[model samples]
Target: MLNIDGASKRGSTAGCGGLLRNSSGIGSGASLVTWISVMPTLQSSGESLIYGLTFAYDRGFKRIVLHVDSNVVVHTLQSDRDHSVVGWRFIQEIRRLLVMNWEVQICHSYRESNACVDALANLGCDHEPGMRVYEQYPTSLSSLLLADVMGITTPKVTSL
Candidate 1:
């Protein structure tokens, strides 16, 4: 499964991140994707999903479960609505990836449960230019990955 999140604050660089988890919920392969060009939150959200899916595809993953923390992205892609807007380009790319002879199950995840991705996104936001790839799980994510692997529960809080 791939869990993703995006971080964008005014006056801060925008970035997104994602991680891959095996069936047993062990995150072995993770990457920290950083976009030097700052963009809107919506765009960053799409970037995260697109990057994660592309990474999985490139790594030869046939079946993937994608977890995204943005409702707009999840709904836009799942609903199959295609609007030719600059902000929607990433959505189109995500759709393109979905049809590439692979089985993908995409869903919305609570933000609270996406601690690791959120951190990665923030790290990317503050990181210097260029991309940072992690073949193995980053040492920085040990605690978050442990909680995820151990099924440590967190409250599912949402906004109205």
Candidate 2:
């Protein structure tokens, strides 16, 4: 499974999300596979997990390697912590899904390593005209988005 970590920065605010694909090379130029965007914050409960499980079950993913940037979410999914909170319930649902035939594991990657995913995530929060496509992307975009999120002027990438 290919895992992507993504973040979006809006003016003085930021949001993050992840994309997981069955193909090992969605962004690496290896294989093409349908992908799913995973957002625990968006779910805030078992709703998203249940939806994901049903979709994965129908799609027949042999093994599921869960990729998550949120350490809290990852830990909760790994243990039987009886967190009855609505948010924790979703984590439990994910755990239950893990117990199925699908082999479940988690991997962590620096946000930079998952730029494509991060861009997609950013779009989810504050989509702008320039962010619609990956091709011809500008590096300055990172600074711009960060500046917007931080409510600061976009920094000059170089003094020149």
Please report the candidate that would top lDDT against the real structure: 1
TM-score of 2: 0.53
Clashing pairs in 1: none
Look at candidate 2 and give me any clashing residue pairs. Answer: 6-118, 8-122, 12-149
Where model 1 places Cα greater than 4 Å from the true spot, the runs are: 10-12, 27-42, 83-86, 158-160
Task: Write model 2 residue lDDT over 1-160, tens digit each, in one string.
Answer: 5343434343433333334355443334323322223342444224333444545555677776655555665566665666547566556666667677766566654444445445545554554322132332235345533443354542334475
Cα lDDT computed for each candidate against the true fold: 0.73, 0.47
Tell me each candidate's RMSD, in Å, in order: 3.6, 9.3
- How far in Å is the alpha carbon of 29 misplaced in model 1? 8.4
Tell how far residue 75 is off in model 1, in angstroms.
1.1
Cα lDDT over the full model 2? 0.47
Q: Each candidate's TM vs. the true structure?
A: 0.82, 0.53
